[model samples]
Target: MYLRRKPIFFLFLLLHPVFINAQFFADRLKSFMSTAAVSAVQYPKEVKEFYELNSYRFSWLEKQNAEQLALLSDYIRSSPSLGLSAGDYHPEIFPIAAIHENDSLLTEISFTDAAIHFLHDLMMGNKAEPLSYDGLKYVPACYNAAALLNVYLSPGRFANLLTDLEPKEAGYLAVKTKLNAWLKITSAEKYEDVAVAVSKTLRGNKNGLTRLYQLGFVASDTASLSEPALKAALKEAQKMFSLLSDGELRSTTVQALNVPLATRIAELKNTLNTLRWLHCVKQERHVALVNIPSATLLLYEHGKLVIESRIIVGKKSTPTPTLSSTITEVILYPYWNVPYKIATRELLPAIKRNTGYINANNYQVLNSSGKVVDPYKVNWRSLSAGNFPYTIRQSTGCDNALGLVKLNFYNPFSVYLHDTPGKSLFGLDRRYFSHGCMRLEKAMELGRYVLTGNAVAIDTLTEKGCLKNQSPITVPATEKIPVFVLYHTAWIDGTGMLHFYEDVYNRFSPGRKP
Candidate 1:
């Protein structure tokens, strides 16, 4: 009985130092947290909660957790590929080589703080500040930082958890993959500016083909290629750049090519940030995604694109604003209720110049009582912008400025998607011609899509047309489709091809050139 007691006492002696060390660390951590210096921590709340949950255990200093710390450091260093700046996390301050016990405890707390920040930024996006013009309204996904660290701090879980926290959308992944690839390519290659010649053909130009090949626009840099092949490659490059795609190496194409790889990388980063901001749209079933920069509309039904159309957005002077809303009503042969500003500032001069202009353009002058008054009866020359007290409206017709269809959604900007009589403008490459409204090339088709089950109603509306005494047909959407007017200058298309557009609104850094 004495020998057995002796062995048990020795076992207790072996565990005593371990317990003492843990208690010492816990007390020191508590004292450190109580000090005002803890206020300097980037994520003080999350750090405190994390340490409290573990009873102030040294998470990063433990021998078994070294691999986890190393993995976290790698992630911090590589954050730029994820559209985050590594400097934000301050990886340099991490005590990777700390030899002192106090340094180790401080390192543990700092690691937890930085890890929480990185995880929060990774999940909820780094750009929390709102842009005045971006009109981003959706709330990002929320996460408990302390809870995440508690679950994912183990050796085997940390790396996988980092990957899992990243955005899983295909578009985002594609851009990330491209960003990494570009990082590697730009590191190895020194790309020189390709000179643009207004009169010379770039078909046999070695410098042009070399730059195009480097950009993945052309298959090869061989100058012996045929004119047609070179032209086709140039068109492909132009398409990717959102240029005219006329198969000519014009100044715009040269400008796009001359844009440095660093600028392209920055553009890609901006695109990644934008995509993360719009991550909520992935859950939406039916959506009308109007990319303002690309001047295109993509209608998605249950996450699959059903309709793609060219669109005319606002000109630079009156850029279309980014906003999110739902399509509620569709109108066929819609009346153009000219805004007071347009009436007094734009059309009033025309009315004054020729009283017959109003009748020729199918415009109706409405008095304060909502009665259509004759434009000829009013003394047009006598009315100035400030004195104008009437409304001007274009009657419903094929020739109406609103064209044949209008999709209305409630917004403070009073902007809506509509058809335009100026169909020829849609054929142009740069379709920025509207006055802050979106002009859809397939407005009638969009109306049909919105009123899917009401085919008879669509047919009846089409037959009615712009006939006199017939009011415009109005149909409410059965299932309201969410519309997101976004401004993304860079994006990956459905074909997995990367494309860049001119920053039409000059919203981003390095504003659009003349």
Candidate 2:
């Protein structure tokens, strides 16, 4: 009797759509969250939260869900067009997994996993290994795991969310488009060699000129005057690379041109990663960004750049730390509270050479109690750097290295942006000459901007100097402006022109391909 009924019961279960779909969803969830699959990665918590939020339902199982999943898969596969790798997000295992009526559960799980990983990479970058620099303070795009799951699982919003995850900064997008165009055009061609034309006009390969034209550095000069036009093209290309516009296609220029497309793509990826951090941050009406690699500070008001000035960053040895902080105050005629490293390595030697160097440089030596010690009476030879306990303070005067102003920010690095009397350094295109602090070319203008966020304060400060003819005046900001000290080797400008700077500190190590 049991055997006779078993066949009919099995047929009933097979015919029931609800029962079949339920089993499919369960199988998909189990395969997706399998310990062997997700145990090694970072998304277990996120995956768990995702499934729990939907009560273990298959996210991409239904027809409507599958349609959205298809769109997402296409986007993931086209990552290379954006200078990213689809493989970086494990698209093979899930996001682009083929969905069928049978094993639809596994396919749905795979697709959901792929979407999560893709979003994570888009928002946080695909860098798996730890970077060497701890100085970078990256505030990653934050999201609640369950909330993100709900959005990605939602049929109406999932596609839009994928679109929104991309970095929308004009410069970043311009580079992305430029890279895509380059890849598209060069897809069929072999990498060609650029001939060196150092100290002379280019004679070999008008192909170089064509390359430059394609790269958007040269305007159309149809008149067949090769030397002058090519020279102009070289100069423009040099300028784009942040080199002196000498108008000669030297070995360096050739080398820069010959940098493999792979290198540029990697650089674009790095820039994209950095841009993600900026995109995730709270957009402030007024802010200052110190791009370390460019060695420039850009001041923005209402998201428009008000001014840009050359800056001196830390040397490669003592690199400037990347961080996000707020500028709360500006000090005019600021004192240079010398760091211990400087006191030992720099000042100690100067004092040993000439005891008078202390007074001549307007530096005062003080004990821990703040009592000034006469430099002449102190035994300079006996004071070793490690054993030294006194603080070296430079007075507010013409010779002071801190110059006329200092923009103070809150950070553990104890570094601030300040003025330098050695303005000649600004003329040099490569300006990585400071200790750890940033030396601003337009310190007075920046100080005023921080204080008042406009030109009024700058005019008053320039005309009358600080209040009451004071040696030092501390001006508090009415609203603290957000400051980001970042390092980006490649970026685009307002005119959609790409700019590449030398990696002074070698912050980006092109590890294994993404």
Candidate 3:
């Protein structure tokens, strides 16, 4: 019994210093946390909770944590390439020379605070500014500080964790590469603003030629070129600006060319932020993205672009909203149920003027009981916008407002993607003529893509003749495809060329500088 007791006593003696050191660290942390200075920590609550979870142990000060500390410092310093400000991580407070000093506790806490803040920004967006447009809802991935720290502290995980968190989408990576290149170029040289005379043609303007040369649109600035060569260069510039490539310089093209380089950089940064907010798309198998500013629709399957189409969005008075939803069904030979506002305010005047207008346009007037009524019998002149109570719907045919097909999705905005009879609108450089819904140039293609296995159904409906269809045929989606209606003024094309577009909605702040 005496020998066993002696062994237990020796074990206790050996463990005494470990317990005492833990208590000492806990007491110091508690005292410091109670002071007002702790409030200066960016994430004080997370920091305290982290230490408490580890029994008040010093994590960054531990010798084994040196690798992760160095990696984190590198990531923080290089964060600008990710469209994040390194200063936000408090890099100046990193304690490289104070590991053995008496103020090491403060240094530990500061480093921990920086790590938490950096991880938070990496997982979620920096959210430095509110989105310019309303009705844009995108929620990024989320993770707590304690959980992220545990993963970072684990063996052989720091680098892999970062790689996982970073966006791997081709579009995002292309923009990031361009942003880094621009940052280096801007730091090395001051870009001179190109001045273009609006009254003169850019074909013969020396300044315009130099600007085109600088932008790599033309081969040479000093050498004299023929009129055809100059026109071609102007067309290239127009294409880069996502304008009409008509080989003629217009006032709208002049505005794009005169956009300052610094403003372009700011636009790139805003694009990065927008992409980060939409990070959830990486996990999806199929996605349809509509960029309103560019008036383009891109369909992706298994992370590859499957289709690209031109789309007509809403006009200025009724701008299309940015939202995320899933396409659930496709309607063939769909009827257009004109909204109450459009029916009352827009079509009412025409109907009153011409009693035969409704039948000429294939529009039917339905009363409260859902029965068709003769438009000629109704008192059209007596019905004002406020007093009109009938539902106006267009019949199914090639001439229907929603031509051939319609893609249905649930959104509070009551907007959906559909085919339009105005095929000529797709040829325009800027197509924003819709009321609020999106008008698709290739609605049948999109319908088939969403209904992958049942694509023959679309062909069958179309072959049966549009005028013969009495009612809309609905095809439920086997797998609902996600759709994101976005607004980006700057984006990198597949060829790695960056394209800038007009801020159609005036979403960017006025008088903003880099």
Candidate 4:
């Protein structure tokens, strides 16, 4: 009976190599993981789940393949070119030679650790240093380790997966190429201080023209170029910085050139991170993006840019909030419902000085119950800043604070995009004038584009003289455009030109070296 039982057990063991192999390798992996160079804390939760799902099978190690180890080594060493710190992944801790010491446990553990760290940094940008300011509330996308591993394990897809990990936007790729150029040339050339408007051309000064060539702003040999050629190069540079393009060495132009190369590189890094964050959204339909720092609005349809316009964002004290929402409707000659803070802090003093101010501006005072209250009935003298109990609303007209068109979106800040009567402000280089809303430069064009599919409503409103009428014209958007209001001080244009805007809110302080 004992001999018969032994043979049965041996047969059962021989038929279960799949389970036996998995159990044997899993035990070794668990033992190596306990004493691995990388700690458990360093492994993200998703990575742990990935290993559990695979039953601790080694992903990067195929019986200690040298080709796989070399690929990882090259990738880690090339991280700096992508504005990443290879040291954070610590690839040097486990040299290829050390990994190939013929100890399978050590080799497998090291290979897994290096591959996971490299992937983490590549997918999510090198975890940004703690920011000192809250001016930007954008959060970067994190990696799902299990999904990433699945992609890696799939045949003939690893290369594509690697390409997809980086930002696929043209702007980001252009900026990254520029970053590499900046790294190679290492320019310290700076312009001298000048007045607001300087009419001199860099061709007059041979040294200045040489510096321009070094900075890659000119197309040809700048040093030997004629005065007209030099002026054209300077004009191009001015345009790149969003200046007036007067082809002169103005103070603002000089200041832009004097910005250190290292500072520009840091801005490029921040822009790359921002691109990664923005690219995570898969929307390809009609969308509107408002770049706060640049004070510009861009509209895209089917992933193609259709409209670009200047905009006036909020001032430093009441800066616009970064958020994402959908524009559901466009209101023509809409009434401006004054916020409580604006009513008590900005307009109350004017009303006190002149009782007719409200009448002159077509404003009406209303109680909480929606009953119109006579302005004269309210004791202007007794209404302290805190004790004001009335809401001031501007009637619909050309003189309305919101101009002719207002874009309605769902946001807690109660901020919207609208036209402004202050048209001259749009021509200024620095346009931060609004309380919190965005003032569009070409508001009518934006309105026409958003109301494209609803042509009858727009035509009817235009025929009815909506602009001059006091009655509001509501146009329901047939196609809702997703609006993303974000702040990016640095970006690249479709022409592959690097554009840098002043950090008006001062969100990024580049103190930590990469």
Candidate 4 C-alpha lDDT tens digits along 1-514? 0011223223432342222244676787666555643253355455556677777876654433333444455666666667776676645443433233235555455555556766766655555423323223434444665657555655555445456666566776777887777766564355332222244656567555654664576644334787888878788777767788988887777766666667777777777655555543323567787888889888777656677899999888999888778888999879899999999998999999998999998899998788889998888999977798788999877678898789998888899999877788998878888898999987877888778877666566556653543777788887777788877777655444668776677675442111
Question: What's model 2's overall lDDT?
Answer: 0.68
The candidate, 1 or 2, that scores higher on lDDT is 1
Q: Give the Cα error of residue 355 in candidate 1, in Å.
A: 2.5
Write model 3 residue lDDT over 299-372, tens digit each, in one string: 87765777788899999898888877889999888889999989987899999899798988999999998899
lDDT values for all models: 0.75, 0.68, 0.75, 0.68
What pairs collide in candidate 2?
28-105, 94-110
The estimated TM-scores of all candidates read: 0.80, 0.76, 0.78, 0.76
Worst 10 residues of 4 by lDDT: 1-10
RMSD of each: 8.0, 8.3, 9.3, 10.0
Better of 1 and 4 by TM-score: 1
lDDT of 1 by residue, 1-514 (tens): 0111223223432333232366787898898998887877788988899988888887765545556766677777767767798888856663243235445556667878888888887776677423333343566665787888878985578878756777776777878877886676667665454544443587668877777776766666664777788788888888878788888777878878767667777878877876665555655667788888888888877556678889999999978888878889988778888988889888999888898888888888999999999777898778987898899988877688888778998788889999888889888878898889999998877888888787566677667665543467788887677788877778666554668887777776463331
The TM-score obtained by model 4 is 0.76
Candidate 3 residue 489 C-alpha distance from true site, Å: 1.0
- Candidate 2 lDDT by residue in tens digits, 1-514: 0011223223432343433466566656666676565554446677777777777875654543545655565667777776678776654543332334554444445656666776766766665323233333555546563557576556566657656666666776777776776676457466443333344556455656656755656664233546776778778888878887887667667656655555666677667666555544435467777888889887777656677888999999988988777888887778788999989998899889999998887888999898889888888889897789799998876678888788898888888899888999999988888888999998977776676645465566577643322467677875687788877778655444678887778765442111
